[model samples]
Target: MTAIQPALDGTIPTTSSYAEWVDDVRPAFVTAARSGRRFTTYEIAKEHELPEPPNPRADWGNFAQSLVRDGLIEHVDFERSSRPTGERSAVSVWRGTPAARAGRVA
Candidate 1:
């Protein structure tokens, strides 16, 4: 496994709700990350039937950053979100890291 990257700016909350939500969806996110395909957060969540976070605006970005820190995924690009609540706004696309594809996890 690779050394996990530090959180970007460390602003993501460490509240129990945030932790629980990340825990709930992490395995699925890891699987997707290892799949070697690019995806927006919304696409992965919807495809994996992931539960919504307590606060969508903050939590989802936080969770994605967590995944990035864990060295499981990296931001690849941005695209218009297909999620209904997203209003077609720009969303990040991500893909697996080499370590993730090799079955390594932080």
Candidate 2:
């Protein structure tokens, strides 16, 4: 349920298939965050071979922002995305919070 929440203060709904996909991929995202390594959404998706959500453009942002809201991850920097579709655009870089690294988040 929380996983399906919107990106910024619930302005958008991550419902239906996108929400289900977000639920399925959340464990992987949390695990990666817990590693304490800086990463972009593109990198995590590639490393885990995750399937794209119903709306790739908005869903990924929504998911990452949700994690930020949950205090599992924090934005640390920005980097050019590696995904071809990203077209060298800057993407947020994130790492796990202390709570997340200590396994306090789920």
Candidate 3:
């Protein structure tokens, strides 16, 4: 993961109601990073087949933000990818924290 720790101190409020997303998503990201494989928000969102009607990124963005805030993952690169809306855009690739790069995490 990149050394882009941007003061996650106040990024997520305790009462933000996004706790569930973090709970469900953090493990998967840790698993992927532990396996030495990198991914992007786009890939994960698409994999879950989430819809945008309720929210553009639905819970995916919330989950990713929570991980980033908790020091579990960070941006590694950018790649052109397809969005859930069928639009192509440059997306940021992310990986687990250094500790999770060993490919052995819960």
> Which lDDT values do the candidates have, in the order given?
0.76, 0.81, 0.57
Q: Residue 51 of model 1: what lDDT?
A: 64
**Top TM-score prediction, candidate number:** 2
What would the per-residue lDDT of candidate 1 be over residues 1-106, giving only the tens digit for each residue?
A: 1212335763232324877777767877788878888988878766665666778778888888988888999988988888777488888999999999888874
Could you report the Cα RMSD, in angstroms, for every candidate shown?
A: 9.6, 8.3, 11.1
Model 3, which residues run further than 4 Å from truth?
1-17, 48-54, 103-106
After TM-score superposition, the amount by which residue 73's alpha carbon in candidate 1 deviates from its true location, in angstroms, is 0.5
Candidate 2 accuracy as TM-score: 0.81
Q: Please tell me which model should have the higher lDDT, number 1 or number 3.
A: 1
On a 0 to 100 scale, what is the lDDT of residue 83 in model 2?
74
Clashes (candidate 1) = 0
TM-score (C-alpha) between model 1 and the true structure: 0.78
Please provide, for model 2 over 1-106, each residue's C-alpha lDDT reduced to its tens digit, 9 standing for 90 to 100.
1333345653334345977887778888899889999999878766765666879778889999999999999999988878787488888999999999999996
Candidate 3's displacement at residue 71, Å, is: 1.9
Model 2 alpha-carbon drift over 4 Å, by segment = 1-16
Clashing pairs in 2: none
